[model samples]
Target: MRLATVADMPRIGTLMRVSGAELFPRFYTERQAASAAIYLTEPDITLIKDGTYFVYEAGGEIVACGGWSKRNKLYTGSGSQQDDGRLLDPATEPARVRAMFVRADWTRRGLAKAILDACVKAAREEGFRSLSLMATLPGVPLYHAFGFQETRQTMVPLPDGVQLEGVEMTYELSQ
Candidate 1:
């Protein structure tokens, strides 16, 4: 895995789109799935800029992408909430795990876990004791296997007026 650069956005976008298109429909309506693939899969430039986002490649193609953020944006494509861009205090707030996606053919290949491992290590290096993410229904099993506990159910409003169901989950880093 390597830190994602602006130059990598196109491939990353492709990965996200294919991943969401193939994965979300298993657990959501066709419209909701399509809306999710459209809205939720947007690349978070801030993660790339902050040097937190990462992509895994095989044969010159990006196969997976994900990141952790010290900023307050829990997820992306939400159209700027009040506290969206603020930096979080590592002492008091969990680092945000944002924008995780994998190529459709790359599922069950440990890619997301590899990214999550990197995120955990990176966040620990920066003094964050925990990490949090809003996991799409299709992603909940993976997050659960990674030791994240569900805190609540979430309904994210997409740009197309569709509400996507997700789970709020948190993971505590071992000291």
Candidate 2:
């Protein structure tokens, strides 16, 4: 895994598109999956800009991508959501686990785990006591297995008027 550069956006976009389209349908309706594929996969360049985003590559292709954010963006979607782009107070606010995606054929391969491990380590180093994420249905099991407890059910409002179901989960870094 490596820090993702702006040049990696094209490949990252492809991985997210294929991953969301292929995996979301297993837990969501086709239309909902389609909408998620379009909106949820949109890369938040802030991650790359902040030097937090990481990508896993195999044979020169990016197979997975994810990162943590010190900023206030919880997840990606329409701008009307809670993403304010303000920096978080590590003592008070939980760092965000943002935009995790694995390629369609890359499931169960420990890629997300490695990325999450990196995120946890980085956030802890930054004095963050907890981590939070808005996890899509396909990601709940993974986060659950990784020790993220479900806090609530969230609705991700997309630009196309589709609201995708998501889970708000938090992990205590001290644990």
Candidate 3:
């Protein structure tokens, strides 16, 4: 795994779409999945630019990507530019676990766990006391297994007037 660069956006985007296509249907209707898929943003450039995003490559192919952020935005990068890029106050706010995606063929291989471990370590090193993320249905099990407690269930509005179900989860970092 390594820090993602601007040039990696295309491949990252492909991975997200492919993963979503393969996994979303397990929990969502075909129509819902189609609408929700629109929200799977490529590389949130801000994360990459901040050196917080990472990509796991195998045999010269990027198989997984994820990252943590000190930024205030919970999520971004689906062709939206409304973020102000404010930094979080680690003393009070939990660091955000941003975009996480794995290729269809790479699921259940502990790739997400490896990425989450890195994100937790990095956030703790940055002085964060906790971590939070808006997890999709397919991701809830993984997050829960890693000690993230569900705080709420939310419906994230998509562009086509569709709302995708998501869970807000948090984890306290070990000091």
On lDDT, the leading prediction is 2
Q: Is candidate 1 or candidate 3 better by TM-score?
A: 1
Error of 2 at 46 (Å): 0.5
Show model 2 residue runs off by greater than 4 Å.
Answer: 78-83
Clashes in model 3: which pairs? none
Candidate 1's residue-wise lDDT over 1-175, tens digit each? 8999999998888898989888989999999998898888888888999999999999999999999999999887677788888999999999999999888788899999999999999999999999999999988999999999999998988877899898999999973
For each candidate, what is the lDDT? 0.91, 0.92, 0.85
Clashing pairs in 2: none
Q: Show pairs that collide, candidate 1.
A: none
The lDDT, on a scale of 0 to 1, for candidate 2 is 0.92
Model 3 misplaced stretches (Cα beyond 4 Å): 77-84
lDDT (10s digit) by residue, model 2, range 57-82 = 99999999999999987888846445
- What lDDT tens digits, residue by residue, belong to model 3 across residues 23-125? 8889898987887666765568889998889899999888999999998878642234455488989999999998888887888899889999999888988
